[model samples]
Target chain A: MDYGDSPEEGAFRDRLRRWLTEDRSWSSASSTDDEYWTRQASWHTALFEAGFFALAWPKKWGGQELHHTFEVIVDEELARAGAPPKPSLGYLIQGISRFGSEELCDRFIPGLISGRDRWRQGFSEPDAGSDLASLQTTAVLDGDEYVIEGHKIWTSYSDVAEWCLLLARTDPDVPKHRGLSVFAIPMNQSGIEQRPLRMINGVSNEFGQVTFDGARVTAENLIGEPGQGWALAMTIVAFERQPAELGYVARYAKTVSELEGDVRSDPDSTRREIAEHIAWAHVQSEMLRLHVCRRLSERLDDPDGGVHGSIDKLLMTWTEQSVGQAARHAAGSATSQAGGDSRLGTYLYSRSQSVMGGTSQIQKNIIATRVLGLPSN
Target chain B: MDTRLSSEQQALVDVARRLTERLGPDGVVSLDDDDRVARLDQATTEAGWRRLRDDDGDGRPLASGVEAGIVASALGQALGDTALFGPLLAADLLRRVGIDAPGAFTVALVPELSSLAVADAGRLPAAVAVDALGATSALALLPDDGGFALAAVPIAGTERSFDLTRWVSSIPAGTELEEIAGSRTLTGDDILEVEAFALSLASADLVGIMRGALELTVDYAKSRQQFETPIGAFQAVQHLLAEAKTLLEGSISVSQHASWAVDALDAGEAREAAAVAKAYCARAAIEVCEVAVQVHGGYGNTWECMAHVYLRRALLSVSLFGDDGVQLAFLAARRMGV
Candidate 1:
């Protein structure tokens, strides 16, 4: 068993580190949420141009066709350099690559990979947050076009995305899961309206409540067979659940470092309790990092997707919450008293870690039922 | 990097598991089965499991740390009552100091049992020998000029440990210790190497204990029925087990990496990695074992139930080198310089 990077992986990591150090243009100096997101987009484009984005995708589609370890390396370096996070478009890419036709893949993948065309996933709705299959969105066949009508809540980056991967019900009479289908709908049309949702962190551009009145997509834009949406959605979320793909370990490392700084700068904060909290925070982060590495290693041996995604999601939630609490403790009054401080923002954002993507409760239920084969009722 | 065990390592695990399951004590009553214990001990000795870290012709060990960890984990899983870790650790220390003395030797720990006992002026301090079983003496570190030397002190007496599966003994204060005549003085790096190996093995044992306890509880939950249905069918019970399983999986990951790091990384880095693993595994094992007991209900608190055995074993491992608190403090000082 080997934990250190292989020779090739070490070379790739060194090269990526060198590139990050040399090119500082992608570093964001923005103050406002709008400017931050704009810089984030620019950063995404910069990473794509540097051949570091979409690393695990097929080489034929503008990806590097490298191991997932390379992507993890990119994340570690980006976090170490304090660069903007790589765009979380792996789920969309997986949805397309696995379920999309050649024509659809040819049309959408390259643009997504190049960061020229931004996209948002329309999975959650007001009523279907965790029970996503119960979504009320409808996509009726109208000649060669599918007229989409739905409201997607918590739609990340919806305001800036040119396209949305929308899931809607195609047959109301069938089962909730079987009646759904995925569509690549254009978000620029007049039929779609995006209202930005201001998060607790006071970030408006990060999430949006998008309302689709009568968005139209060509029948050819359909992701898979009409009834294949449930399977496709599951596949996408499984990829989304991967912590390595999200660069969460690096993100946690950065937070822990910041917390360490906070504790060091304040002599009064050297209390044993505070030190232990920070130490545990560091331990949790390392645990998550090693756990993700083992998962990535297992993927190399057998790439089959399984319910292990739920395990990863649960562990990530634990680590994030732990680090967030430590940061809050270290920051003390500064977190609440100081305005526009990233520490306060980060502490608040960590509250949403267990709620977003999938609620901790739901993830546990998935593990209990699917992974452990426990009875649902 | 590959984290999966090699086929040979996998086979070693299989052999260890089979041996323990066949001869290991099954219940509290079986703990008194002297015949069974002897057979198990003989099997482990014949298999050369304790000599995994013994020196090859060169300075390197006969097997990697991962192989040693695999056997350690198996022992913990079956609650195997033998002296594998003690002998293995003793061998590791002797090999690091370039000594060839081999027998039923374990390492002597400080009075707190938090670290190896450091002898002074050719005399052994009052110390504890863990997993001493049939061992007559334990190795200790001796101060030599600016470096450390290896010495062996006779075990003065035995004490009943909380972990019934292993033996704990003590050394008298000011006991004369025999320093290996030809053994070379060891550097700080050698100490760290031994430390890394100890922590890795302890972490792996915790991982196995957690898994064993969880598996026992999970099986009970499946078979034990209440309110006209199996308890496992309840979401509360299922969620508890699921969370336990999740923690166990994470422990396995970190523990595996720590074991691999023992030989793969530099001494300092390997010790850091092992500390991280121990901290995580120590806390996690306690929680997982508690969950196991909780899920087992009234039976869990009784002596007949195997859950308490796992908890007892985990408690010893947690404090063997240092618990999570100790590790966290060490890490905070090292990483954050706080």
Candidate 2:
């Protein structure tokens, strides 16, 4: 089995690297939370314009229709260049393109792809975090619109997004999973109220809590059939678990390199324990990177989404947490000093890695029941 | 890049698996079956598995590191008590020095068994011969100018080992060594490549050990009843097995890359990859084996259950080159200059 890039992939990677090296307009650092997000948006637009975003999407939807490895290359190059992460909208794009109607895709995908319109996913509530299927959100059909009323906690990007893809119960009599439906509701409506939540990293704009009093969406905004939201949500999460698509491996690599550099620049002062931690972190990063590559290669043959995503999610969590801990230890006193380095924020944010996408326990449960064919109570 | 095995590699794996399953020991008791052990050894020798790294007349091996790793993994899964890795490693060392291996031989490591042994003043120092079953001699490195000269030291005696499937021997202190004629001096890069090969094989063996242990435990979980139902129905047991499976998959990914890198990448790069794989697989195998034992409950601790055998084999592989801590320290020194 070959691990090096194919000829076409090598050429594409070289071209992308050259372009990234030549472009320095989007490299400015931001000071405020608002400025950070604004810069992220501009970076996203620049990537899309340069054809480095959504490399796996269809050409008809403003993508190059290249292999997913191209996407991985883009992530690796961007991280190597110390650029802001590529926009994390691949899952949303997957959900809409696969489950949304033709008119819905035509109406929303181009805008989302081009970064002209931003979106947030409203999947979890205070009571329905891990048990998402048990959500009590309701969406009722009334003439040409569906009135949605739900409380969504951890609604990321809600302040900047113009639309929110929501999951609400459409038929209550059936099982929880079967009764759900997805909707593309406009976030600018008067019935929706968004309150930004301060994250552990002290960033408020990254996450919000939204209460939909009586949000209205046209019936055409329904993603799929009334009972298809569960499948669509699963598909979206499976895509989200892919570390390659999410650029997690690249980010971890960057962290690992920086840690190594820190230890190297002051070897006489650095402790062996910290050096070992950095080495351990490097090992985790390499494992995750190689694991993601193999998974991406497997997807080339079997594109069907399956329980394998749970495995990827677990590995990603482990790598992120390890790298965060290594960075914290490497930073030593600097982590807690005034005007704290970013390592403290990173270490704190890593605490949510196992909690945000799916808890480690939940991922294990999925692997136990679905992948291992273990019986459940 | 493709990570899946090619058709030829898959075929090699199938053949190795079939041979081991047919002749290799089935349990702890079978390990003492001299007739079966001899038959297995004869079969592997006839199959030319040990000759995978033998020179192909171009100073390169007849097969790549992936091919050798596939066989190593198969042998590990079946607990095949054969002289494959030792002889193969000896051949690899000889090939690096542009000489054909004379016969069945293994590599001599320092007393701690952490690295290759270096001969001093035309005599072999006290060293260990790992995987030395049925081998006449072990190869050592003799310091020659800035490079190392290849030497063969006679194995003095076999010693009892924690791992029952393989044998270890000792080289007497100040044992006279003979340098092979017509051999070229090997560079530092050549030694690193050999270490990479050794580490990759060890990682592959750990992967196989984990696979075997998990499969055995999974089968037991499916059949062993508790609380009027199979214990596999319980979330605790299922999670243990699931986590073990995840670790096993991670080990496979890293090991695959390491084995491929041995022949496909530069010597330094390949060594780094192998070090990463070895570190991950060494730690993962212990945990996976422990879970296997835990899932088996009381029977797991017994000698007859076969779970302990996998653990024993994994322990040996973990110490073969260097455990996780050793690898991490080496990596830290290399990457961070610590």
Candidate 3:
């Protein structure tokens, strides 16, 4: 029934905020692929060393074993203090802890927890984006190893990561969900090359298509079971449904705080739009807290659950595109006349949030068929 | 984050189900007629339908009112009785706002109605629409900065088509209607929330009707023979029936989600969620009802069959609150930050 954090939780948030503000190692541009992989890995190691990354994870694996609410509190507090994003590796590590096997965890979690390395998601192929079932990546079993050969599009930060988290078909004759396996494949091996995929947003010199040709990785590298990759991929769908501006709390607060009164000023179309954006922002922030409530309830209800993650994913994508649109529309000439380094450039760059993760139409399809109970066809 | 209903909410669902079951499939059909309004009147007075709202003649709070919405959603999914929603929702909404609406009060449904015209100083609905209407008791007039104004003409002597579930009349051209009066100002988000509430309730009722049609056709398909095998066994009939099941389930989910969104309205997100749910539900209801007729074969074409009623209701329900386009526009506008 309580809508937000208790005093105890608030204090915990304050501690996280203080730490982030004080951490000289944390850089605003740390998430960019151009950043040195070794430096990012070292930073991630520091996070795990301090028990900042895996606080929500169980203690058996050198984690603080806190609840997701605590993790959420950390995220919010970090944002409050303008903390740089915890490396993608740190975020994806949670997915592994949720779905990876003991063997896989043993091989990866320690290094990941210690920030020795990171992994990229090799999910989409030429023909597979919304129709993920149509992915053509093939992984053939040879005694104890899966020799994978396929092209993965939109593998963000692949070149910067030590490994790629790949989804490949192992049993093509079965249904799509039953034919796929998830792997943490090391990318430095021969026959693996990542070619940058040029994007409309100019920020994607780091993201590219990765081709894995006869890339041999042991069965031990498989994160989940041979055919349970779909479930594992869906493990964090609820996380995707987070509110409008996620970890960008300090930035969002700064942007909207500067624009609030101008939006209310009379005699222009921008006023209504800006005011609406602020209103939307407030609503989105509250919904994020509500999302926290939904997340908190998961552990209490179904510790191991089956609710689809597509709904969350879809909502998150929508929120991202929306906030980006609001920023530009509210900023007027400042958004369009970009020359010197300004937020307008960054605002425009945020446009790919939907297309990068998954398109809006694809999200709707997921909601319609999987979440809303409509026939897929 | 915990959206799971408490055990008390769960019990309310159970109690509502028992009531729907005891009342049977024909329970909703009975409510469509003026004579059958007594069922809800008595039920609302008794223990089941108004568990939250009709307590000791005092109104339920907004949050409890939300629980009631969830109950209605479950009822629609289970029994397919779409007829009883209007009065229940109108009365419940009235209760949430602290308005002491009567047990059998009716609501305004004219599409052309607007609060600006109603609340304007000089203009008003005809006197006949206000007082001497056929059967409608109250109007949800719009209030501008001044007095509440009659939004609809509700013209009398227009030769009524359907009367029990709804009514028509005329009102004075410039009379000042009653304002909500109590100290409450609905925000834009609140407006969207109410719209979502109303639409979700209606769409749940639509689910009920769709289920009723599916049941009717399925029963026919089972017993009725075509050539040699029961029509139900044929692939053609099977596909149609299966499709109906998908549609019924689809509408059920949207309606369910929309209800949950409003019930747990931690913020204004319910508006878009509601719009999405309403748009999908509207499309599903039409699809299910249309296919229901096709599955029924020749008998479905006749007015003697109740399939036509489902068709009529489906078409009517699509544009009742707002059409698919209007709602999506509302949603997409907000989404695009326009």
Q: lDDT values of the candidates?
A: 0.85, 0.86, 0.57
lDDT of 2 at B78: 86
Candidate 1 per-residue lDDT, tens place, A180-214, comes to 99999888898888898988878888889988888
Q: What i-RMS does each candidate reach, in Å? A: 1.6, 1.0, 9.1
Chain B alone, TM-score, model 1: 0.97
Residue pairs in steric clash, candidate 2? Answer: none
Task: Name the best candidate (by lDDT).
Answer: 2
lDDT of 3 by residue, A147-172 (tens): 99998998866567788888899999
**Candidate 2 overall lDDT versus native:** 0.86
Of candidate 2 chain A, the 10-residue stretch with the lowest lDDT total is: A27-36
Distance from true location, Cα of A316 in model 2, Å? 0.5
Tell me the deviation in Å of residue A99 in model 1: 1.3
Q: Which regions of candidate 3 fall more than 4 Å away from where they truly are? A: A1-55, A62-103, A113-116, A123-151, A166-183, A189-191, A211-267, A271-299, A310-377, B17-41, B48-51, B54-63, B71-338
What's the TM for chain B in candidate 2? 0.98
